[model samples]
Target: MAERTRPRPAADGAARNWLGLPAALAFIALVLLVDLAAAAHAVLIGFLALAPLLAAAVDTPRRTAAAAATATLAAVVAGLPSQTLGSLDHLLRVAVVIAVSIAAMYVARARTGREERIRRMTEIVRVTQRAILRDVPERVGGVTLRARYVSAYQEAGVGGDLYEVVPGPDRLRIIIGDVCGKGLPAVQLAAAVIGAFRQSAIVRTRLEEVAADLDALVAREPASTHGVTFVTAVLLEIRGPRLRVMSCGHPRPLLCRAGGSLVPLGTGTPKRPLGLGGDRGRPDTHRWDPGDRLLLYTDGMIEARDAAGRFFPVQRLARALSADSPEEALDAVWEAVRRHAGGPPRDDVALLLLQRLTPEPDTGGCGGPCPG
Candidate 1:
């Protein structure tokens, strides 16, 4: 769902700029000191040329130009006391420093333009992805819900994993899936799958019809996007105290009951991933009681590997999610996953946590459990 996001503070950019100029000045000073101290033994003033180049990396073009000018002046000044200022060696050093500084300024300008373009593109992609997979509400049809999307591609924050929570008249419909490829094509396919699911989940009374619609949609995608593309999905319909799950070659969701009991739901044989044009098996029925938590996630959570190549064991570490609320629980789970993998996930991860709230007695809350 739409997680809270904060823009990068201006101070961050200011700090970067601050660092570059001082660093360049420090390098120039160091080179001057070395050149003056070692003048009797060796020539080292040429090293001043690196000051502007270093500034180009993190400073603006104007600052870079300043650094270049400073470096050129330092080169000439350092050569003066040694009586070598008019020599060909010192003249060549000054010329090379000027040329290098000019190049560094141009490089800094080009790099700045490219960085701005990337920032704009990144913002656009983030908005588009958020539109496709809109945020899930905190409560839907009496169920508390929390969702998260993590992309392995940190720069883009876009991937093929998708999920949606649709509130029905008396139930909550949910779908989670993973598209088969990467890049923009995979993101497109993921959007398509979510679009199809959002449309069908409301009208189709049965989960099978919704699954069928998604399968057909993926199968019809053009081959040009990829040789062949398919999506592994799971369709869920939560009605009252019962949960119906249908797996399309996706991972089985974990159910965490009160007092720290965890069970894998949807044990039935699964069908082919969507787009393969195969039969989607019947939905598996499970009892979902009050205060129970259901964890739905893409395979990325389980397949995450650590430095020693050991796959993350979600089932074992799931007890960490015993928090009082789904959001807190999810944060704990996400942290555990990152710790297990020793870094950010290597694949797209989509997580949806559903909790059946327990009503307080005599407060107009439903005393009995919700219908199945």
Candidate 2:
């Protein structure tokens, strides 16, 4: 059997040292003085007298009832001792006050219970979302990885923006993209993109093919039968000494080299956003020198506006990345964006950073027909 649970005190016990008993006692004394004369209006006096008891009852219902009973007994003994009519009138007035106090306590208790239930439900939803979008691992292939996502609203998890890294046949493939809108509909589109990328990244050797696969998946969804979501994405493949990139209407990613120089990728022109057509523009490729870092992000970072209404320039972000580690670079970029936005962001932001590690020296080649 579930153990019987008593209703807990509504207020902190230590904070209310004497439990507000003194205030209840003073209110009762005032009511008694008003009742002593037959000219006193008991109805109006009873309403005013019950106010303190009702407040106390919200915190300590039992104590409130005790105070009400004691006040009523003392008033009858001192104020109505000489008249039978006065004694009956005082009894009726005290009864009404106690009834009102109990009713107020019940309402307060019900509201508190409802709020607690809602809080618990919200916590469960947050946990489920984290399980779906776990943080990017610290290391992928021969590169160190770090990433961060901040939702526009408090307690929100994994909105329309997304990022993922997958170990591929010849390289580590990375993706960072944003769905068209916000809220649940956008979240659904984001999940679809993440799921499609995970499968395509492993099978498709080229970054362009991986991007095309994602676009096909989103366009075929039943919800897309009428209208399509425009997803801006960048697919990256990091090989031993080479980096290939495919852009789909996404913001240009930044590259920070070992010697502390910043360069923006896909600078000249960019491809159209995904989910609208089947044709993809040409992919860009570059050599990955030792200690090079790649930074991919959603538009929320650059579009953030400061107090003077100036947008956070991508050039400034690239400069900051050159001197900072992957983790520090992520933090600096987010701080700059937040300061630009004044407070909390009004849109979802996602970022992914990858640092090329020094390649391990080759020892010996594996023999043909090795044991499976």
Candidate 3:
């Protein structure tokens, strides 16, 4: 059963505990030797109690208490060789060692508790964020669709990156973007941008209007007061075989034609990222034939770094996709990124791919495919 097969890492902790008491006693013995050699009258080497204090950080409280007891007993025995056990001074040295160990144990426990609470909170936040960024659909406006997201750290499973697709009988609209920062505030801002897109995508006649509306929504939010952070966004609208794109300080998307040629799209001069008041530019249009694919992504995908500090080559990889469908292409791209990074990412990545599917057979009187 899966339950029986799960690994238990805690089993190793007990093995490590075996090393704790002896190490503490050895440290105390060394200090006693130094005291004897120097012939100091005062317990000048009592500072060596720090060894047990450090042990408290890794060992359980019970184990740490045992180490502290061993250390304190050793210190007392060492002092008895030089001073009488009945002397009040000898008791003071022993108490100092015990006090240091107890304080360390309590502080360590408090810190561990705080860390656990934070980890649990992070998990709850990641779950909510995933629900917000979940996939839109498998097919949209005669196109097969795929989307993927990767968070920068495994501890914090999601960040400011966002993506969405709204399918309609006559038009398909998609948005991919990255907020200026991470944390709950950035996620709230990303959600606001998606909400604006959902509300205006169908009603607005032009991509320019949608962009302006999104900018207005972000500009009016409380998060906009800082003025430094902005959302880099690209909006795409496709009506039948015609595709239009409007970029707002976001990276340009790539288009893979049906004929096996790949090219990055051009949306003219870049505008300011959303949140700063600026003019919204017009959208560039393209003709999308069946079998053509469009790739939309945030900077996180292109900016991922390897151990050598080189950035991932998004365009070069775009030209390399030879998958049979959009889903397979997205998987290949994700796998390539994982291999390049070699571990958890340093930034959140959001990707969306749309491939136009072949049209249905024509049953018109003209014996040809119907025009949009």
Q: Which candidate tops TM-score?
A: 1
Which segments of model 2 are wrong by more than 4 Å? 1-107, 359-372
* Residue lDDT tens for model 3, 1-372: 000011234764665565555566567677777877887643754665676776666656666677677777766776665765646787787788778877867866676678679768876876676667765688754778877777675456667888877776667888999999888888888988887888898788878888889888888888788776789998888776666777888998888877667777754587778878678756776666778888888888778888998888876665445577666787788777777777646788878888888764333322112222
How does residue 173 of candidate 1 score in lDDT?
91
Please provide, for model 2 over 113-203, each residue's C-alpha lDDT reduced to its tens digit, 9 standing for 90 to 100: 6756866765665665565466677876688888777666544444788777788656788889988877777777878888888889898
Alpha-carbon TM-score of each model against the true structure: 0.92, 0.71, 0.71
Candidate 2 lDDT (Cα, whole model)? 0.68
- Model 1 local distance difference test score: 0.83
Clashes in model 1: which pairs? 240-371
* Selected candidate, larger lDDT, 2 vs 3: 3
**lDDT scores of the candidates, listed in order:** 0.83, 0.68, 0.73
Number of colliding residue pairs in each model: 1, 0, 0
State which candidate, 1 or 2, has the greater lDDT. 1
